[model samples]
Target: MIEPAARPRATAAWLLLALLAAAAYLLGLGGQHIPKNGDESVYMHIARLTAGTGQWLPLQSEIEGLARNTKPPLLFWQAMVAGSWGEAWSLWRLRLPSYLYTLASALLVGALAARLVARPGANDAPRPPLQVAALAVLVYLAFFSTYRYSRPYLTSAPETFWMFAPFFAIAWSPARVLGSRLGFPLLAGVALGIACLYKSFALVLPVALALGACYQVAGPRGRGLFVLRRAGFWSDVGRVLLAAIVATALFALWFVVDPAPAEVWREFVVGENAGKFNARESYLGKALAGSGSIWGLIPGYAVNAGLLMPVVVGLLFAAWRARSGADASERVLWLWLLVLLLVFMLPSQRSARYLVAAMPALAVLMVLHWPRIARGWFIATLLMALLATLFALNVALGVQALEPSAGGYSAGLWLWLLAMAAACVAGLVKDGWTRPVAALISAAFYVAFAWVTAPLEGPAGRYDDAVIERLRGEAVMVPSNFNGDFERYQFLLPGARIEHYFAAQPVDFDGLPALLAGHRFVIVQRRVGQPPCADERAEACRVVAARWDIRSRQTNAEIRASLLRAPQDFWFAREYLVERLAAAEGRP
Candidate 1:
């Protein structure tokens, strides 16, 4: 345990790490290939298309099938405003709002943690809330999900902010917010409505369930049982019902305002939301089986933490151990987490990402029980960070070996990696330093990743201005093996229309030219050292420009090789922009 006299110094160190974690998130904001959800480009597509139309009522997208209006317009509107309707567009600028939202959510998480924790016993000197709050914020940012999902111009950060804002308020002042019949609930509804606009109106069910359950818990306590009249049950019911109505009404505004209400209903409501509860598979079977099973979701909070999963397990046991005399406000948070898990189970389509909005509660609970959690969890996190930093350092050194001509990551990045390794070593050896160092290493690892990938978003990995200029109005056939991935070309090649063909790993090299038969300009991917075109097809197409790329999807063999041998070969690729000289006239 940290001595009382030195606790302030310890808290200061945590506060510094919190600031570092916050700043790290912004360092490589504009990268073409950074850690992010696959749908980031898809969301960017809708936002760009909607901005092109000069209206926000109906969300626009060029994506075919049910993906056109898969989500409401708030996220699109955010991108439009951020990009200045495409006048001053950049990936960094577009992603800035999500970062801000993430920062705000972190602040709220810290605040909730600070509030939920009770004062230390009279025997101990008064401890600063700053210490716990800063750790909470650091832990939240250190989450791999926070890094993966929050940084992209996606729904996760903003939706997490608006959706969790109500709980933050309720936790901050349970007496006032929970007691209010209409005031707080109205605001909560609007907040949730905004969240729904970013995600789906289906979220209202979970949010409402959480709200009502919290209200019930806030009611007069009498022997762990509910007496309707004494518990103010009807008033609490009114609160939940009113909030649900407001949220639903606000979401329905899409239909009221959009030019194509029927399209919105069919595409968004039915295909996007209602499709989750399919009659083809029994709900119980869906819950119990396959990759999307509820079992996967049960441990999501920890899994989302990535390196700190052990700490989450420790936090869970700590919560269980402290359940008997827990604070009511804290119980509200537990109820919120429970409600999310329960409601999401009903949908046949379940994902760990859906549990993200509950992470703030997890952060608070961890902070409240930080001391109670066994030290082994913290040690495990430090060990994982040590291994990851070692791996990244190896990759960095190997990158130099692979491409000596192109300078690898800078000295500062090497030093950063070394620093994380050193800190992990120190934490592993010392009990008192373990927790704070665990957070620093987790956050540091993300920064290291961003620094290493920074060059990919720079001149070295991208096509020169000349290539982007020539391909302005042309149709370029690009390969896409994942959802909305080819949409990345809209930014890469500014006025070009991108067409896609499936090109998964073990790329069909023999069929490369056929893919470019109709299009004058096309992009093809090949592993480094491979020829741009097969010998027989050399005359069919000519390589105009080539740029470095990363093969994000890898086979098991590639993963094994990356882990055991040459990672640079498996991770890096060369993307060629080819012109079909064989085509008679290739405008179409």
Candidate 2:
């Protein structure tokens, strides 16, 4: 048992961990710009519509002919609440809830660690429960996915929290409430229900597996037969059923209450959920064949977890080495990790984010076995840190050689690189406190890396408020053939009315004059090696406003050629603001 005096220190350690998470997730949050992608914009648009419409049932968007019922109403509701709190709607305000969710996830991990470590069967010989818990929090905060997706208005952070909440809840339930009743299991069901409301019914698989694993391990000799023999086992089974029923009922509420159930059924149930799994080209397949393949997930996982993947491997190896002696809690955690991996791997739409549901369990297991794996962990930490420093220096050198004025190659970046190098050296020197020190240093490195290298929308040159201002309150025509660039336009010019042409039909230059009869402005892409005006009919429109150095929407072959031909030149599209001179002049 933990001593009375040690409790305060443990509390302090938890507080410190919370502070580190807050700093990592919340600091410089508003300063960084949103990515130039449709995902972020799409959510933002839905949120804006939610706030404007206040109906909140259908999950609509501002863009015409677009209805988004793919995701549930929880995130959109959170975004609406966030939008209302601040005076003006900003990306930071929209994303504030995600930061809080991320912090809560870290706290939950820490709490779960504390619980497991304090248990009688935990391997606490190598380190104290408090120390292990602290390391777990650090590991979570330093994860590459935590750093990347934690600050965005994405579903990963909340989904990760809700899915893992039931495990801890069920574990701590028997102690908090009376046995053979509907206390903890019911609560676990509610947590699962909330997760379903947040994402989808897919979460049910892992939750069921975790609860089943817990039941199996809770029995004598970790056997399923013994668990089946117990009277309380049936009660536990009832509780799990209760949880699933509750989760299912809550999810069904959407279908019951929504104004357009058919749309939800078609869009969400079929398009998003069913379509994702049935697709022949899985995300994993695309990764392996298109870009890097199966090996890519390694670096992807490492980078997402703050380059502590080697430590994860070491912990796994250590756990395997000592598997014969693992206690109930360790077995449960391993089962949780395995179940998540198995369920996620079966789906075609695999991503690193999909594996985030298992990270908290992985962090706890790693900390539990840290003492046995300290040497390997330390060595891996140093090697990763060294590699990171070398890579940073190489990139800095490359930027200095190619573009001396590049934003990333600055004095501040150099200082951060040196600081990372110093921390790695300190970890190598400090023998007794190496693990904690490495955790602290690695967390700091990721925090610094995030703040220093956070991508800004201004650098992309995709959206210019000034250019957008020119078209404010005016109807703008966009080619339906252009991918999702129009979403960016809608984001920039929220007040401007937008209409799509050639949506169902092919682009006909002869019909340009008739299409521009009523519209004064049309946004079109000017591809490289193509004339500004494609044909004679297009000559009626003259360029009124153009933003150079914007990324081009072209095929891979063209992009590759452009990169090869003009290595130094910015490979961006020149966005043309074409005005129909005839229409503007009211000519016949």
lDDT per prediction?
0.82, 0.64
lDDT of 2 by residue, 1-588 (tens): 447778678657755865765686665565433322336656766767667776777777645544587578887888888878323677668788888888888888877787777776566452465666666787787776776776688777788888877665644442333243566667777777787877887687777866766765653323555557755676666666777888878888888888989998888878778865655665656645643344444444444466677777777678888888776556666777777766665555556666777777777777777777857666677778777676546534533333322334457777877877887877777676567655666666655545443422234333456757767888998765443335445544556787766432222223456666778877665433343445646567776665433343445774566434542233433456677876656743
Q: After superposition, how far is residue 44 of candidate 1 from its true place, in Å?
A: 1.1
What tens-digit string does per-residue lDDT give for candidate 1 at 171-283? 77788778776789899999999899889999999999898888777643322364466557777778888999999999999889889999998988988889999889888
Q: Model 1: residues >4 Å from true position, as ranges?
A: 1-9, 118-126, 220-224, 227-229, 405-407, 534-539, 582-588
C-alpha TM-score for every candidate: 0.94, 0.76
TM-score of 1: 0.94
Model 2, residue 487: what's the lDDT?
A: 44
Cα miss at 76, model 2 (Å)?
Answer: 1.4
Candidate 2 regions exceeding 4 Å error are 1-18, 31-38, 62-67, 85-87, 119-131, 173-180, 219-233, 279-306, 389-410, 426-437, 453-469, 475-494, 497-588
The TM-score, computed over Cα atoms with residue i paired to residue i, of candidate 2 is 0.76
